[model samples]
Target: MEKMTLPDWMKEAPTAVCPASSGKERKGFLDRSLRNFASVLKRAFASGKTKDGPMQNLEPRAKLAGFFLLILAAALFESWIFILALLVMTVCLSAMTKAGAAPLLVRALPAIVFTAVMAAPAVFSFVTPGAPLAGVGGLTITAEGVSTALFFVLRVSAIAALAALLVLTTAEADFFRGLGRLLPGFFSAALFFTFKYCLILVKTAEGAALARKSRTIDSRGVKEAQRWFASRAAFILKKSLNTAEEVSMAMVSRGFEGRVATAPAGPLGFAEYLWLGASSFFFFLSFGF
Candidate 1:
């Protein structure tokens, strides 16, 4: 083998050294928040790709009606036990749909946390007057308040979980088309547009946040961050207006006259009937408390 000479730059030490990074460049709070929010939305919408499941096999209209009944039950029932039972049922259905627990938790966590926070006030004595269950830093948590809070949190959790499961198992197009069939043409069109608009807004916000983060080399002061946020908000608002105008123009070009035509939803079968029966059973059971 022939010996090769090394390049001068490769053999010699560099005159100047590159500066070390001043800690890893972390994403700003808003950037991270937007990224996560966008991720959740994408996952929520894309989740119906699960190959096979009982829920997936059922008609969208049946799933919609059944899930609505369950959510209604959750709202109508005051008993914590009923709510807890509904939550358990939802979990079971989620499992059958192959909607993994981790994804369910990811999808449900924000709503669960928000519900808990909002219900927290109801646990205080000042909010719900009753016998004191416990004392924390001179604040009395009334028993009734505790009960009320628990009930509220559980109900919300059950409802949120059920909603998540419904979305996870049903394809977006089918679900929306079924919804269009169930609702009046004008209302369904509005809902369809609103859903699409929200998704677009989330995607736009995520892209804006990421672009801002990429451009930001140094940490900024609160005022600078606020100004950046305001600018971004205004940009998003303007973008949305433009998007709406474009959508309206496209719709008009397509001969839209305020009504969106949707294909008829599939007829209910045995699986759908069973689902409805189960939903009805639980709904009636909720009444017994």
Candidate 2:
């Protein structure tokens, strides 16, 4: 096999191009882009934006349980009525928690758009014998397909809303602690590490992005975009891997095994059981029984 030579950066990626910005505007753009990258990351994990609500006061265990039930109900639901009820439930909980409606929509809108993009076409997949509801643009839309599409949209929205509810209600730390309580020791450690490392990785990527934007123009053409992304991804991955190594070394030096140093949650009280019961009731009702 013959060895081949390519650009030195086929091996190097995100932070390799930390060239000086051309002007104050480029510098500001770099700063804002990096900050926005962090902001998106903060949202990805739990953030103060989503955590300032009454739902946050709920026991993490209870919220987790409710989330599971909400997902289940949403999954089993076939009717728009059930989905609407779940949405109403989401609204009520969000209101009670003082989580603003706009924020909830912001959290869920991405999921809604994603479901529409994928599910709109898939709705017609089932070949149930049904009359055409309408026809337009050379496509015959059937009643079954329309109904299926509606069901999928509702189900996805309800599930995403429930997930958002969890994020809105539970702090990342408490969520991990609650998970630690129920799960086996190793599993809990994994969850805690996953939560911890995700932020570190995001920051690493932001630094990488600042470096990249300083060196390259954000062109709209296909080849440019592809080159930009491929190079950035490679660079981000390198930085993230190094960051992980540093974090691991620091943790080890501090005697941090993967296990969390959390105080045990002790025992569940009657209220928790009561909350669990309520979650079950709502889940059943929402599933059309």
Candidate 3:
């Protein structure tokens, strides 16, 4: 290959110049934060794709009720086997619903790891009483304590997986509508608006970051970046408040009352009843184990 020649300006430039301080640019805190937030938000919203899957055929209310019952059972159970069973059930359900396992695992791993970290101290004899298994300086790891910690971690993971499955399978509008039926109108409306505005804020922050990046020529120090991030956060807050007001006015213009009104959903089919019955039976069986 022929050698490429540098321009006079490039040849004269310092070779040791930091990429950020040089003409070449690097993404700053705001840029990175916004990009990451946007990606997560996108994945979360995108997961609600109701295709021709098992969950899509079920009535929203039935799905909501069955999930809650299963989650309640998971919460009440103490056995590691029971918790593992619930986790397996969640994975199976996600598969039936055609929700990708990778995405579900990605979402659940953080919560699972965090729960383990929080439960770590419980394994020590000083925190939980039990026969000693292993010991370090001034501390003993006990068998009972390890068992308790494992149970806690498994329970948390099971619950998180189930919750992720529900979100992945259900559409946003249908999910919110189900909530409106089960909850007070004001609470449901607030939740709906909160979710709506959160997406709006994410988009707004992303746009702001892109705008800043386009205008920026040289990178600033960490302190300067921190100040900018703080100011950007304040601006996003203000914009959110203003947008909320506008949305409220728009709702008023459209004859919306203080309550959210959802159209009546059709009655549950026989398949739904069967699923619900199976869910209830499993929940009851959990109490025995």
Candidate 4:
């Protein structure tokens, strides 16, 4: 290979230009992460604000009831066709919400990929009638085992879709509204603000990671990269913990009483009753399959 030459200025770099050994960038990253994490937590504890047309009218209790019913129905289903149909149905229903089903699917694709990777091996591990593939690790793999794996994939996908539907359709404040009605007196039911802060924490974590990446030098090798990543992670974790404590104290100082209670769903009007019945009927038809 021919020798490559750099511009004259490139070879005359000063020794004083070396990176700071005291890790100022790393310290700055931790500080920024801590501040952001605290802010994120504050926002997360705040109740979800936006609401769309249909979701605005429904009682909080009604939405919660419907959600639990749907989850129960999905869980009871076993057939591949039934599970597939339910997943489609969830996406279809999700369209009525402002967030819509498409966005939900996009957000959930990561979990879908993970589930597929994890479940693929399990399918071929056990033998059943009409085995499709050979067994792994001493067990006889069969067509039945493979199909069973696929069945689980469909099952989880459907469940995830339904959960997504609830997120799009349900308001964060009313989440507690529903929870308070469903499980009154349960301490977990009183965690609406906790959920709010949790979102903040997630945002803080992301911000910290991005800030770290922007400031830190790229490592040269695989092992060095791993160490670099771990160091950054530890920094984030420490900052996040400190941030969380500050947030908790701030909330306590602000008179945040931890209790969630959904106002009762008053007697359903004729239209509300009709729609509720319709939803139940459609859900049952899907459930029966």
Top-lDDT structure, candidate number: 3
In lDDT terms, how accurate is model 4?
0.64
Score residue 166 of candidate 1 by CA lDDT.
Answer: 77
* Model 3 per-residue lDDT tens digits across residues 98-183: 88677678879999999999999999988999999998887999999999999898999999998888887888887887787777
In model 1, the runs with Cα more than 4 Å from the true position are: 1-23, 27-29, 132-134, 197-207, 210-216, 219-223
Candidate 4 lDDT over residue span 117-186, tens digit each: 9877665534345645665577666777677778877777877777766665666766666677667645
Clashing pairs in 1: none
Model 2 lDDT at residue 40? 82
Candidate 2 residue lDDT tens string, 176-208: 777776677678787777778778777766766
What range of 10 consecutive residues in model 3 has the weakest lDDT sum? 16-25
Q: How should the candidates be ordered by lDDT, best one leading? A: 3, 1, 2, 4
**Candidate 1 lDDT score relative to the true structure:** 0.80
Q: Could you tell me how far off, in angstroms, the CA of residue 278 lies in candidate 1 after the best superposition?
A: 2.2
Model 3 regions more than 4 Å off: 1-7, 10-28
Clashing pairs in 3: none
**Predicted structure with the largest TM-score when compared to the true one:** 3
lDDT of each: 0.80, 0.71, 0.82, 0.64
Candidate 4 regions with alpha-carbon error over 4 angstroms: 1-56, 125-130, 133-141, 185-189, 199-265, 271-289
